[model samples]
Target: MASASTDVDFNKIVKQDQTLCAICHFSWVQKDARCLPCKDKVHIFCSDCLRQLAHNDESHAEGILFCPVCKMAHRWTEEGVASFPRLDLFNSNNDDDDDGNRLRMRSRTFVDAPPNHTRSYVEEIIVSVLRNLHNQEIQMIQKINETAANHMKKVREQRHKLLEEVLMFYDEKESELIDIIREFAAFEKFSKKVGETNKKVTKMKIRLNNKANSCFHRNIEFIKDSSLADFSIGLNKKEEEFKVSKELCRLPTGGRVCNTSFFNDTLYLLTEKFGGSLFFYKLLRYQMKTGIIESLHEWNNSIKIEYKLAVSVNIYLLTVGEIRVQRVTETEDDDGKFSCTFSTFYDIMRRKNDTTSFVHIIGYEKGIVLCCQDLDNIFTFKKIKDPVKQKWKISLNLPLLKIVDMRINSSQLFALFTENLHYIFDLNSGKILNKLKTSTGSPREVLGITKYRFCTKILFQSGCCLIGNDFVRLIDKTEDGVSSWSYKKIFDLYHTIEYGKCSEGIIAFLILDKWINTVYLKYIKC
Candidate 1:
């Protein structure tokens, strides 16, 4: 009875054994099929379909071929790789029973090639690469030679014109000398002909003296006013000597100054008092020339003045609770007062708790931007025409983080984070375009940044100055878009520095000597 049951099960299994491809879901025979190296060992598809799938699944970067079923990578099996059409297999007048054995024997013979053959193949590839490199070098040398020839031609033309001018001036002077010699000879003849006291002799003597005098004046003028003296060649040299003028302003109470900015070319310092009830915070205005420190205005309110910004003809004084705009006028009165009038204050994000928060302000295009130091919140304010309501058009928040310093140009902003990371972001979209390391070697000891010329230090213009206790370097971008620092010992090292933009290539920075309790106004020629 058990033998009968086993026979029935074997019959059932053989009846259900029909081969179907996993990929196409069509019936396939065992002759034209391949399988992945998996535990199932079931026929998947034909070798052509498997090769196509492998080509599609190959990852160029990773340099690996993946299995379609398991989604895992593996080396090619011998039988599966030999089934490819391009590979030439051994042909013999044999039936299908001996085909697999013959193919295995042929593959083994191909793999056992001579060692010298592999070595020669690799050497040929290396020689081809070297030849290509030599051709490129030849082309580069030709380009350089052509460029140098053009520059040399221009230099030769300049030299020819200068030498010609020099030659012409000397030639005319030689003619003038000949005329003077003739005048002297004629004067001697006249003296001999007329004897000492003759009337004609006196007139001739006067004429000779006048002619000689005119010739001397003309020769001197030509030599002195020549264009040869006007030629100046500029060399890339460091300017070490600076014309410095310094003044000192002594503060009565050593209040912690928050920030500094320039408006209408005048210096303004924002100071905050810690505990005094007389004046909580004050804005001190100093004349750049006279070094006069006068309190422009004082506020005793609970909300603190964060920072001041001068953006596009408008002076914005931002505080924690409200934003104030002072219309910076072009005219100033004789009493040393700006013709600026304060507009009605606009509201900011109010303080949640008693915890202190610092707001950094930078003047951007057509508006002013304010950022909080603690939170990643940014706001843009544009002064509108209607003063009564919504005078400052505030934009949506910008997600900036841990901003330590910010420098603004017309288009972009360079935000320096607390971690010494520098980010360049566009103004309109608020998207970061690039990030770079500000310093490479030491712990960051950067004090602040001062805007110079048109752009800041990260840009490729007349670079700005970066002030720090360890070093004060003028950083500029190179042609390959890398920032390089030109170390400058232009100013004395101090604890804190606050600068205001003066004329082109000039800046007025205040150095606060913490030990002496004195502030020095330093005018720098950058």
Candidate 2:
């Protein structure tokens, strides 16, 4: 072979062996090798060189080895061999297979490996979760703080507002007290002056007593011939008249009449026949002086009238727990006979099953106002457009209970009780202005009487004559300063006599005599 050898081309031979190891300069025909991270023709790695490189690395405990040239890591076995195999360039001839192998190589280099749950990846995930939890905690704390701050701000504002209101109230109270103190000082000065005047009067009274004593001794001899007659006379005038039966007027056709009212110089009587119908009654109207009773209207299918109030030509009759407004109209025919017609009934209060509970019914303005027995409450109804339609207007809760009678005077409503206590209320404002205890004790009945107007009064007992005693006193609110002026001696009634409604200058009284069991009307001059 040496004798036949010619000049050999070394460059050609080197070029023919393209698949060789770049790390050891070994041919791929004798040793196993892999492409390095560069993946070029000259940069190929042999297994032995890779083993030696992995053995010399400090990070090999992680089961991975990396190339020194490109710093690309590869998975390595415990024996310091590359676990991922590379395609041999000298064996493959299929283009598809070569493309697939290149694709796999690129995938293995770029794609992530199996998750290392025990190392830095898990620690990083834990750190990120902790960071999110910390942020959420900070956000919650901020929200809570904001809520607390808002609540505190509201509390402070409310506190300041309440403080201002309290201060204003105290200032007003102080001003009132100061005015009261000034008035009290003036009252004390006047009282001292009155005391001095009273002392002088007492001295004069002592001198008068001495002079009277001397005069009595001087007139003792002269009184021997003078006669002293009995001074008690006419003390039982009304008492004597009550024992005798005095006829006021003849009885009407109706069986018996109890409640009566006088309006516009005419007497209105409520008469009901006994044992006929318990709930029906006949309303009779009679002239004051003529005494001729004629049937004005009959209340059929209604509870008997208990209380009534007449004002301004309209008669308010309370029957079956309802107050009705009745108006009488008169018309003259060609025959000169006067025909009267009653107006349609206006329903004010239609309480169910409360037929006999009414204590008083007062017509105020255009509505009906009432107070019941044993009830400390009062209610008012207003007149609507239609007479049949009425609405509740005012409801007042009174401080004093056991109200016996109530009267409306202008803008004030006066309520009287059985214990000599009276209350004054504002009609428009529904506020109780004052409650006063009168000097009179335990009134059986209280009548708010005047010479010009109709007022309220409780029904008096039979044979009761309110004479000489202070029955009622009109209080002048302007000058008297809530004190009553003088008691007005109104009237004295006989036995079984009851006072009825009063208008301007006249009042009516009904007398039920037991002699005939008949009802008579007595026209009283006011």
Candidate 3:
């Protein structure tokens, strides 16, 4: 037979017989005959078809190959043809008659294959198979990467959310802690205040108890002494029988008694004499049984005599001089011979050139208060050691319009004067803290002003004295407005007795006439 390559159109053969071996069909191609063992025979000229057939026939190692036209099994080998076991075919037996169903057997003849053959169709098939595999692998890798990236992004978002939650929790915890601290501080402060209040209440209770006990003792004493008190009625008396003797040292010529004070059962009489001479007399009450005459111990010239006596207590006598103070004291002796002695003197006069002019003494402990026509000043003394001397310590100036009378109550001193003025001053500092004006009667000439040590009663002259139907109106410069002075009428004439004690509720102004000897005792409660 002529060469098939000369008779075959190679392009038409390759397109028509895609499953036929190109070497068998006589195409100018190199055949991959090793892939033909599983009977997946195609054109060897198409390399793409060969590779595809080889991938589909993985059982080629078992050595089974078949030719489509000849229907014959062949052995696959790269070098030479090899023998392989054949599959058994069924034979028609004598039991079946030759009807139209008789077996139609087809015969195939094997041919010897050529080696080292190259086919263009085989090369194309191999290249196409590799390209398809590469494309599939690339698509799978892209999907895996996308999945991993998505998972990482989700993890980051979760971490951020967790951090936010932690911060919020911390803030809440911090707020709660701060609230607890503030509450604790408030509790501490409240507890402290409660403790302070408790202490104050305890102190107040102690003071109240002390005051109650003192009042109780005073009341008991008053009850015990009530019986020994003397009671007299009316003011009538025999003036000639109970008379105040005139033998007592009379006032010096051209002098008058300005003020007087009784202390330590002795009398301090201050007399204003001419030439600014002050006659200070220490009067002792004569003991009727002793037969010793009570006489004036010492006499001295004072700076001025017109000043008022502010305070007189025990042996300490404070006298105000002209712009100075004369403090006197009695010498200490066991003989009981009452004699007045001069302690020391100090000058407390201020410079007249200073514009800040103040001259008022409101209170004193061991000092003098100088009472002028419209001013008052205090001078205190201090005892000096080493040389053993007393000196004027301090001076307090106050606003007072003629200190008419002053009474002490504990540490406070109440001073009454003209212009209806009343000043309450500190006894220590002599500084006035309160002032009041009386609505009615003027504190003009205080006849008998008394202050009960145990009571809050102040008694003063009202400038009105009644002797029966006669009203003896005394004219005086008082804190109140001025008024005319006269007697309303004259009643029965009577005698008078001037001796009295302030402690007695009733002062017996004894008055007696020829008709009856009745003692009119005026009972003043305060």
TM-score of each prediction: 0.40, 0.34, 0.30
- Candidate 1 lDDT, 1-526, residue by residue in tens: 0000110111112212233445544433333444434444322455566666666764622444455656555455334434322211223433653433443232111112234545468766665675466456656656776786777776677667656666776688688789889878878987998795775554455444435444443422222233433332221222321223343454436577677675555666667776654547666666656756766665565544455544444556655433344443234579876444455334445556523243555654455555533333554433333232323333334454344556654344444434444555555556565555545322233323222222344443323555554344444544443343422333333344454334444343535432111222222322
Q: Of the candidates shown, which would achieve the greatest TM-score relative to the real structure?
A: 1
lDDT of 2 by residue, 1-526 (tens): 0011222222222333354444554444325554443333124567777777777886777866666656666556553444434435434444654333232221111112235534477766665675466456556666776786777776577557555655665576566556655655655576577773454433333233223322222211112213323321111111110111122354454456655544445666666665555655666666655646666555555344454544433555654344444555656678755556767455435467544244555544454454443233443423232244343444444555444544454323533343455555555555555555555444533333221111212111111112113232332222322223222322222122233233321132434221111122221221
TM-score of 2: 0.34
Model 3 C-alpha lDDT per residue in residues 1-526, reported as the tens digit of each score: 1011111122222332243444344322233222223334322323344344334655435553343344444443342221221111212333544322222111121222356755477766765675466456656656776786777676567557555655665575566556655655665576577773463433333233223322222211112233422321112121111122222122223433444443322334444444544554433333222323344354546544344333344323344434444444444458755556554443444656522222333223344443332233342322222123342233334344344445444334434343444554444555555555555344432322111111112212312221212222223333453333332221123222222232322112222211111122222221
Worst 10 residues of 3 by lDDT: 1-10
Q: What's the lDDT of the predicted structure labeled candidate 1?
A: 0.46
Ranking by lDDT: 1, 2, 3
Q: What is the Å distance of residue 254 in model 3 from its true position?
A: 10
Provide the lowest-lDDT 10-residue window in model 2: 235-244
Models, CA RMSD each:
30.2, 34.7, 42.1
